[model samples]
Target chain A: NAGVTQTPKFRVLKTGQSMTLLCAQDMNHEYMYWYRQDPGMGLRLIHYSVGEGTTAKGEVPDGYNVSRLKKQNFLLGLESAAPSQTSVYFCASTALLGATGELFFGEGSRLTVL
Target chain B: AQSVSQHNHHVILSEAASLELGCNYSYGGTVNLFWYVQYPGQHLQLLLKYFSGDPLVKGIKGFEAEFIKSKFSFNLRKPSVQWSDTAEYFCAVNVQDYKLSFGAGTTVTVRA
Candidate 1:
């Protein structure tokens, strides 16, 4: 089964442009998250949804927005891309919350903003 | 805000050498710790995790970690390493909230 899949595996955007990264999970998980991975920053949470129709800000939510219209999908949107946003984005999903659950990660979407 | 810290940014060792990567978290109280590995051009995969139990946890690829509550540390170790062990390792912590904070990551390079 494809646990987590991220769309637009690679993208290049000029400054001020907007784009969205799609994350779809077939695992029927209840929680989903968006994270950005930089050279040394590891992974920083951008936004998350506990379930369908529920979204919350994460550690690094600025400049990014997320929507969980359906339980299977979580979309991360960059309203206006900036050079600082040039990083690899990852999507993750978990069947449960807290320490008991393990997160399944997507392959990642590499975005470059010029 | 809780945070995870990985002491080594980069580590290089010859094959068959013992390997250890230090990880620490700032959160007190109960916590769940995790170690994730990312091979070149691949998605992050679970190396190991500790929720609650004996404090010593073994994971895939002959890797293991020890949880020292007093020290607020969860260090990963492997008795012997191989060239295929080369990858970026991350330490993560899950507190009460659903959020999981990750460390800056440690790049391990095992040479043949």
Candidate 2:
């Protein structure tokens, strides 16, 4: 079964351009998260959703918006991209059990802004 | 806010050499610790995790981590390393809720 999948594996955008990244999971997890991976920064959470129609801000939520319109999909959008936003974006999901659940990650989308 | 720290930024070792990566967290109370590995051009995968009960947890690829509550540390260890073990390792902590805080990551390069 496909675990977590992210779209647009690589993209290049000009400053002020807008784009959306789509994440889909077939495991039917209750929690989904969006994170950006930078060199030496590891993975920083951008946004998260506990369930469908519910979303929350994460450590690095600025300049990004997320929506859990469906149980299996979480969308992350950048209204106006900036050079600083050029980083690899990852999507992860885990079960409802808080402490015991392990997160499954996506292949990651690499974005480069110029 | 809680934070995770990985002691090494990069490590290079010969094959069959023992490998150890230090990880420390700032959370005082009960916490869940995890180690994730990312191979070249691949996503992060679970290396090992510690919730409760046994302080030493064994995971895939012959990797293991020991959780020391007193020291607030979860260090990963492998008896022998192979060239295939070259990858980036990350330490993560989950205090409450499902949110996790991650360390800066340590890149390990195993020479043949």
Best by DockQ: 1
Cα-lDDT of candidate 2:
0.93
For candidate 2, chain B by itself scores a TM value of 0.98
Clashing pairs in 1: none
Q: Which residue pairs collide, candidate 2?
A: none
Model 2: per-residue Cα lDDT over A3-68, one tens digit each: 999999999999999999999999989899999999999899999999999999999999999999
Q: Tens-digit lDDT track for model 2 on B1-112? A: 8999999999999999999999999988888889999999999998988888999999999999999889989999999999999999999988868698899999999999
**For model 1, how does the per-residue alpha-carbon lDDT over B26-83 read when each residue is reduced to its tens digit?**
9878998999999999999889999898999999999999999999999999999999
lDDT (0 to 1) per candidate: 0.94, 0.93
Deviating ranges (above 4 Å) for candidate 2: A97-99
Residue A62 lDDT (model 2): 93
